[model samples]
Target: MTTITVSPGDLPLQCLYRWEKERGPQVYLTQPTGGGAVLDITWAQAAQQVRCMAGWLQSQGWPQGSRVAIIGKNSAHWILADLAIVMAGYVSVPIYPTFNAEALAYILAHSEAKALFVGKMDDTANIKNGVPSGLPLVALPLAPALAALQWADLVKNNAPLSGQPVADGDQTSTIIYTSGTTGKPKGVVHTFNTMAWGVSSATHRVRMDVNDRYISYLPLAHVAERMLVEQASLRYGGRIFFAESLDTFLMDLQRARPTIFFSVPRLWVKFQQGIHGKIPAPKLKRLLGLPLIGNLVRKKILKGLGLDQCRIAAGGAAPMPADVLQWYRNLGLDLIEVYGMTENSGVSHSTLPGSRQTGSVGLPYTGVESRVDVETGEIQMRCPALMKAYYREEAQTAEAFTTDGWLRTGDKGQIDAQGFLSITGRVKDIFKTSKGKYVAPAPIEDRLVLHPDIEACAVTGANLAQPLALVMLSPDAVARSQSSEGRQTLSTSLQLHLQAVNAMLEPHEKLDCLAAVTTAWTPENGFVTPTLKVKRNKVEEVYAPHFASWLAQGRPVVWADAS
Candidate 1:
């Protein structure tokens, strides 16, 4: 076994201290607002704001360990509040900005956050739902219309913490809420050291230099972003630029020109769909197949997306269909697949450079021990970066760790003879059909998702005779269905493409019944995780009530259920 050593205080905060000492007030964050660099904050300047906020918190007179939540989109203020919460010696709970009112209420109440910092209140209704009783919230980027107190005002007016600064190495850093298969949310508590360890471990695997620029678009509340941005950025002294909205996301990306870009399968699917729609796949493939045209076409496409200089492009939070992986690789964009959970501080393994393999999540990072439980086939990990416990849930905490402390990931995976790990299906996700045959949905869905039409899918039939799939088609696929239906008249010529996909799939994994919900699966809707993986059970419930007749039909391959 190989080993990697990390010295104490060598985390993100250490990076900031280095930057502050070496280069005074260099730009660390920026967002293009109006004219010149709308918002830019240097390391020292940002630290002053954080210290001021920390002072304000000390003035609040709450318990030192009370959970403080951040309720808004990404901003310089958002980052500062997160670091300030830690500086004030409080646990920071970063909530998804898109969570609906009911979910907001549930999380706020469950986490017992004493105060909140809300940024970008465009979704005020959702914000209101999570507002705790008697708890004060300071809103950043406060507009005239929003009723929340201004976070900037609070920080500006309050004095900085007078005494010794908080540099606790083992304090509880955060409690990130992840939606459960049971339709509930569990808060995963991680210590500063655990998160710091994750960043350091990933640095060795990815070799993140000080020059790396990360676009922080994924919800910071997620383990993926928290470790990468909060922990890794802090340790490596990289700049973080948050996307303003969909309108400016591309512009922001072009402006930041990030060295490392990480997005989920859904976003990647959208990008692929955009390119496919612009130039039909068959035509583009034929053009690229030509010797002279191939390199030029790839270069043009990469430049158009501003990924010509991207060092690493990664996709995770869900299994990436191999064909999509191939499509990008063909265009000279090296997108690698990664696999991990919140329990492992977001990244347990990643496909290392020069060792890329499609259909496999790749080798475990240094110091992370992974073994498949022979009985259940579930992957278990023992690492220095493992979470302290599920917040306030003692029984759950005890259940998570083995007697010797290996964390049960609950994800079923297999390691090839050479140690490349491929996740198959979740132990909790695999269920028996009414026929009593155990069905692993992820593998089946992975096969079906390779079809160009499918955007996202979930397979469910726990007690039914056979498995069924609920698919959300890509925008292009939906548009093509309109024309395809006009041309054909039978199940052979369909009004919807789900039937076509069902035909394309190998029998059991095919769609048993299909319906056009036409709604996107997103973090706010509770159907997807913050990192954009479908919460399979939530997806099943949302569509299951509409699939009664299909289930009654014993999972026969068909179009919509016959009323």
Candidate 2:
């Protein structure tokens, strides 16, 4: 693989022009249409369409710097609309399609978005109702339910925008609302330079080129996917493929054969569960332990999963279980865990390929300045790609930064002598017990979820004398626990599992009991964020009251039917 050098120009739009001029007919986006068909758009075509849409947006006479919200799933038109917003001198606000009507309304009103772009959605009527009464709506090509100005019609009717306006480096390009796991979403403001510099600098660590293919399945509204997939494609001229739907995800993955792939730990765990379901764990482990057949088994599994062609597989958004990481490594895949936040342009630490260390997010990317504060152990960073501010919230923005200037990451982490960073937990998530010991629940939960049957777990004690674990079992695990005999078996196994986990922890940090719950924590339930990180506060709010009762029962493991 030859190294591809990219001159990321002062603006991302400039890079678009450069790619259009050099690789005019090269396919830039491969979008999936209905009935197993795909629509390929070349670099030149993409640029022209963007310009046409920009011209239409300019004609709308929206004020400069006005917020124009784009609500949709990942698609070709979504990226085009984001670019058109920047080209038209307005700020782009991308909303998660999974957001409820209430969240949609909150972001629309808070950002004061003048125009709305609608794309493929599950509940079009509900989303449409969330749009402000007077906001102009433009439907993307696939959003047929929305009776609004069609995207393709506008592009065909308008002429290409002449003389694309150059954006100032400090000009706000987009306002990305954080997944409000704790409360209402706060808008994160990023400038053109922040996007360009962050993506370019981070891509240097992982080599990319026109030949590289990527699957854009993760919500592009998240900063990590936006930077890694969208901006990386802009900078490196890579071909991007979009997943059509959940049912066709594997087929889409097989079709793309992406060279670089990224997914949150939750999805990664699901993939593991899917494989384990197809092949029973003990048999699969025995097969993999064989010398001759192991290679063939791993290859067959990788090919089946459509990851045979993947070179750099990354896991982020939450701490990946070490056992899961090792499972992929055993199959000859280097799955690196990356660490970052929305305030930092999602460019922080990443494990290098072939040099991966499980449980660590690796060293900070080149040109990124990172340090752990002595007192709080909170990670602070100063970089060119850091967000400008939280939009319209000066008090919150001021609190985000230290008195000096470093962006406070709010994550408690430690850097080893060799510069590798390991996230311990969130500073705010640390809770004190009634016994006067402060406990960080993440490390404990991480250990608990290492059990194969456990899907997700949260540790909470708060005002209680000792901490207890609230666990959500995997689907298969839930099925196993349905019968009286199966439940007893699972209870015995998990009790021993908890004993083993407790053996490794200090007395103060040990979990007093484990409560196996029936309810699965999911994004739809407001228990997990879009990025798949468990909302610790939300989990504690629902389960803390039961902790004392469970502990008072004097049982090592208590089963709660929380469904």
Candidate 3:
């Protein structure tokens, strides 16, 4: 087995060159098409494509520090464009394909992206309409809507770059825009040195090597997916597979047979639900009790999940349910929970391979110094991989760091004597869905209250499949709902209002149900704080016991039913 060693000064393109020379024929990526075709590209071929793309980009004579944006799903060409931008001395700005027109426009305009690389998109028309005029558009092979120079055309017409251009380790590598709790998304700037340091630490912690294979399904724009799947692969020389689409995820996973698997808790729950759908919980438990049968069943279950060969399975982005972790462990797979943030280049803490602690997100990684703030209990850390600053936001950057210069993680956590960190809650009011998307309740609550019928609402969904909005009807609205006919009309209006509200929310932030409490909440009921603010936790405590029932009702609006 060969071990690849990379230094901070060594650009990723240089690593590709080494791989091309040492093992040119080795398959680097497997790109699947919706038509059931699989395209296997070798290291030599990928290097040539990247070189050609980079040369073409350089020929454009874009100024240094220019921002080039890539919006696409996880694919080989997406990565090729990223490498090309970096090697051509431009910074890459990756936008999530699912981003609405508003988000897409903001990122491009804010980043000052000179060019955009478009790939497979769910809403091509929305993208076409959102893209500002005069921004150069280069369509990838899979982009069916854009009438621009295709990726293949560029590769065929341009010559491969002959030599690696000198790129300083301290130069900005990319600007990753993370959704914020207010206003617009914030751009997190990372230098080549930051990325290199982070990836090196992650690789060391995960024990990655050349023989590993990864399935790239999550958005490449996200720092977690980039680190675990893309950056780790580049640093350690691992083969990567791209899923064709969500519908074929299982098939793609089976084909990849990845040695390294990383997914968010939502998908983990879906996997559990999928297995339970096939094999009921009680039946599974009974079957596992039998010695010979249990072993066979476990192997079968893992094989079906495409994790039979997985060496390192990890869940991150949000807290994974302990039961779900135990379920995987029962099948002999230790699903490690990783904790990190984009500001830290996704380097912070991760549970070691065999050190299984159900709720804790393991010890800090090498060179990461962590402490619980005495006043706020927020987890703070300092590391070499921490981003230099938020792009164009000096005030926010200053606020992110403590007086002592440590990065505040904004997560309330407790460190055990054993050094394992358990996240107690978020310091901010933002709550993350199972899919790991953050929902800022304030914004959503503001929208909900605008409806004349709704007086106040609290948005909550901690560890839930989706967020729920607890609605309290206004007095006039409640007075009209006494009659059966009036109640029906109100329900209809509320349903319509719910739909309208959902239309404005991101997929993960969409409410699962609207529970309208008959009793009014006020300061007298202790549901309001002394400052006249809603005690969100108190409201949740009173109604949380009914949440499962309300969720199970499956109605968009479930009225108090006959018990």
Candidate 4:
């Protein structure tokens, strides 16, 4: 699996010096901090911390295309300051340590980011008050700032050098931002020849390999987990691990036993409500429609979510919930679902490996090129890793391309006739309903978040007069309201699962109401946005004044009678 000709003088962090001159430590990454200490990172300590953090950012006079940024959470020095901000040629942006500080003071003063690398979390000592008091930072010892300079204090007495060696089709190498879910978040750039022609146009559109491992928890500051962790793990030389918190993500997915596990559909509806909170959806569909107890209850629920040696388990950003993709295809985990947008660098479509659909979003994407503007079915697309704009804004990158260019993905879709697609929502999450009927609340909160007592839901209404969902339950349904007979049996089983999800919605997107809040719209409550989504305009401005007496008393409504 070696092919070259990648050129802005050849880099993508020299694919960790072609895997340390071809496989050396036999392990690339496996972080599970101290108590379980294992840092691993090799390919010669990740090409000697990408040449001592690109030779101390070229002895700090910060020049070349200069931009830097790199916020926090998800580490290995958040991929060593994203490969020393592209081997110090510079320009990396990233921010999303759950943004706020006014969206990192507008992307650290709109990517004029001279430097910053913050990652360690609990908000890296308030990221230098969200950077811009003459921006320049270097903290990084997994960021709980013990007087900064950490990456072992900038390579204690630095050396292991290298100067220029960057090209794999170079253009700008990394920028990623957009999870602003309609408002601030913008900057979406890329280049190492548009991410090595999007990692060989997605390994020739999904026939991926190089013994693919991918288990790096999402928010590599996004763009489908930085094109599956920094350009398909440097164009598929794979193996990356990370996750060990969310209470030991299934024992760090059975100690990094990954083959390809990327998540999103709100963590695949909390792994199908953690397998219907331990079986019982008609006995987990009679043990997955038997015939060998359906591959041994889909190999014991993918070996209890260590994802039984994954082998491709995708789901990306949002829209996916065809009953959680037919309960991960009745547990055989071909979970698939993918559609893209970091302003088109992640993908243009997917859902292929053994044709999948469960309410589409798959197809196209081999050097992508799509359409659907059959008058606002929106979608458009074009990709060559799209972005090359939007960073410095230029009128929202000239209204996100077109006039013979494509890329307008403000999400609303169609496409069919075999080129899949589906989507049908997010033209600013659609609204209207005093009877002008046009509710589209993500297919009724993807069918009331496959009720295992939902863990997140947000279907607000625009000019009001209908659609309402809000929900945030599940901490095992608010730890069953710490008993008074488990809060009258979780308010009579969430009012009989919101009366069986409003008798399967449609009377003007029924769900006419349902409050239930306790606060799990996480990213430390700005009502979610660090890839866990929800900031539906800050949960309609922190629950629109406690949803005004339950929308002037119409139906459902209950966060203890709307507060």
Candidate 5:
């Protein structure tokens, strides 16, 4: 067996040059058009377009290392634009497509981007308001009609860039803004060497090759998707696929039949709920207990989910519920938990493929060092791929690291005897009740989401008698609650669930009641981040005024109208 090795100093462009010479005819990207139409771009074709775009970028004659912004959902053109930015000796600033007008404007103005590349987006109104006046705008192939330069026109007009241009390893490659939950988003700057080092070192833990395939559905603006899907594909010469839209996600997954799949915990829970919708849990459990029928049922479920061919499946960005993790394991899928953050270039700890430990996020990746602060119980880490600084914010950057240089992850955790790391909670997420006892919401919320009726939850009580849990029900549960009997049934089940969760907690940490929120928690509503993380501060702001009143009249379960 042979393996591809990359040094810490290797650049992404160098890998592209290698693939262009070795696998030029092989398809590198598969993009879905509406109505099931598709476009397959070979390495040779991608290289030519990237080169031409690079030439056009150079023609603008922006100073080297000037910031260039990209805003769009995940697509082949998104990746190509990023590569072109790098090839043109510019810094790429990727803004999440779901960002509202304010966030979009902040990043663009703050980065001082010389130009912007607009790609596939569900809403163009945000872009219209967010883009500053007189800034250059280039539209990708899938972009909606906009008053901007066309990508096809530029490629057709400019010749391919002469020679294989490479960026210096130490030059800035990108500035990834954190999907902040508390305050304004901060820009995390990473150099070419740091970004390349992260992707290169990750291969040692999860192997990939030219034959590997992936579906790039997660936002490429996120560090996880950028490193795992885009950069990893460039390094290993793998084929990358794009999901057309949310409506066609399943069809896109089936088309890709990806060999490597990565997803967050919320999506994983939704997948489980979808499976249970088709096959009830009790009957499915009974079938899985049988001898040969169990294997067949497992395969059928995996096939239906479009993950039958997945050799490596992992979850990150948040903790995986214990029951959900075990349920996928029972289906013969090794769904390991990966733990990392944007500041670390998305490199930290990950569970090995076949060596999973319950309730732990595995061991740290090779070349990574981790420790838990004795006083604060915070998890601190040092790795070669850590970011250079928080862009332009000296105070925040200084606060993000210790004097000795370990990145402060802001997460509290424990390291087991076997070296497995189990996250206890976020340091900033802990709240105190009126009695002055602090409660860690993460561990308790993990237990709350295990109920099939609940989709998401937040446990919060500041200076109150007892902490209470505010929960958003799953879509099926919400629909079922429309009827009188159905509402009563859901109320009783939630009461029981509240009792079960309380029985496991200490007196001060126990919840007062379970409040069912009638409104949805979504990114648009500012209830959750783009990555689906609950915004604790937002939850507190909207529900705090009614907390005392609800606690006074509350039984084991109560209802709150967010709207």
Candidate 6:
């Protein structure tokens, strides 16, 4: 594991050139084509394609700093297009592939993008209505058929850009839009220097090298993926693999055998549930306790999940349930919990390898400075990688930072005596009951989701007598509920689960009842963000009207669709 040393001031393009010169023949990206076929791209090959595309972009005569937008799923071409955009002296704006037509249109209009690069996407029905009339569009290799210039044509028509061009450190590199859990998405601006600083500083803690392998499946639009996968790879010169689709994700993971893996809480939970489906929880637990057979069972499970080679498995985007974290640990994985936000380049804190503490997000990164506000208890941190500003939002930009300097994280947290940070809840998310008791739903929701049948849960009862939980059943649970016998079993299990969760909570925070809903919550339905964090406001808006009726029912567990 030889580590690459990069200067803190080196920009992304600088690192790209270094890798192209040193690791020219080494594979840089492994992209999955349909039907299990993969295309291996070398560093020199990727550099040539990037240079040709950059030349084509430069020939278009857009201003040096004009905005260039990319909309698509994670693919090798997506990364190539981003590098080309920066190489052409333009700013890149990456939009989530799952964004609705309305969101797509708003971002394009807001950013005033000069051209758009379209790549592989699961759904393109919205493109017809989402893209403004007559916007210049270029299609990547796997992009759906569209009336646009093709990437192959551009590469054939243009010569590679002549010399290694360097971008100014202070120049704006990208405008990343937040997932917008509450309001309209705001563009977070980061300079080349800031982005470089984040990647360089993070590598000191995470320890990546040319021998490492990574799979890029998370939304590249998110800051975390951008920094960890794209930029980090450039700095460390590691090979990256792309997941073809949801159906082939496991195959992709097995193919890559990634040495470093990162996932959100929801996906991690699904992985756990998948294992339990094959081996029931109680039986699996008993099997794992045997001295001789336990190791074999652990290896089999890890190999089946394609995580046997993983040295660093990380969870982020939301607080992972303590029980879920322990489940992976029991299988010989030290799952690290990372904490950060879009405004901070997602390089704030991460638990060290082999030193994980169960209920904490771990220590801050080398250059990060953190403190909990004395008055509001909000976590505040300032670092070199902090965003420059919110694009075109002067008032909001001013409000994001304190009068002195630190960026307000808006999350309430506390630093323990050992300097580990534990997030309590969001300041804006705390609500009060009618009796004047305030309850934080995050902790309670964490406990409720420990039930195998529960997929997602939200606790809310503002101004009501007692707080209540709205739960969405797992796919397995929903399938079983089709039978009367299975439904009865689920009802009994949920009632007992409710009682156990309530016993662990304070009187003011105990849930009145658990209401299992029939509707599925997804990004398409505006219930969850692309990162899969529940939109608390949206959940309350859709279910608040039924609170009184649900309370009136005397049953401990009620079905929202039941008559």
TM values, all candidates = 0.91, 0.94, 0.78, 0.34, 0.97, 0.97
List clashing residue pairs in candidate 1.
12-234, 12-235, 434-464
User: Which runs in model 6 stand beyond 4 Å of their true positions?
Assistant: 1-9
Clashing pairs in 6: none
How large is the C-alpha RMSD of every model relative to the true structure? Answer: 3.2, 2.7, 11.1, 22.2, 2.1, 2.2
Q: Could you tell me the TM-score of candidate 6?
A: 0.97
lDDT of 4 by residue, 52-157 (tens): 8778887887778778888777876688678777776788888777676777877777777787877767744356565667566777755775445666767665
Our tally of clashes for model 6 stands at: 0
What are the per-residue Cα lDDT tens digits for candidate 6 across 1-563? 23333353368898889989999999999999898899999999999999999999999999899999999999999999999999999999999988889999999999999999999977687788799988999999999999999999999899999789878888999999898788889999998888888887777787999999999999999998998899888888999999999899999998998998999998998999899989999999999999989999999999888899999899999988988998999989879899988899997888888874688888988888899999999999998889999999999999999998899998988999988999888999999999999999889988888887888888999999899999999877888888889888988999999999999999999889999876778888999988889899998998888888888887788887673
Candidate 5 similarity to native, TM-score: 0.97
Give one digit per residue, the lDDT tens place, for model 5 in 301-350: 99988899999999999878888888998998888889989999899999
lDDT of each: 0.75, 0.86, 0.82, 0.73, 0.90, 0.90
Candidate 3 structure quality by residue, lDDT tens digits, 1-563: 12334374345766777788877999999999768899999889998999899899989998998999999878988988998899889999998776667778989988999899998876586577778988888998777777677889899999988876658888999999974433567899998888788887776667887899999998888898888887877777889999999789998999999999998765676677678768988899999889999999999988887889998999887666666787788878878889898999888998888865687889888778899999977999998889999899999999999998999998888999988898865677767777778767765775676555665678899889899988877666678778789888988888899999899888888998888755666533556421133567777777888888889989898664321
State the lDDT of candidate 2 residue by residue for 527-557, as single tens digits: 8887777888888777766666777789898
Q: What is the lDDT of residue 487 in candidate 6?
A: 82
Clashes of 1: 3
Candidate 2 lDDT at 67 equals 93
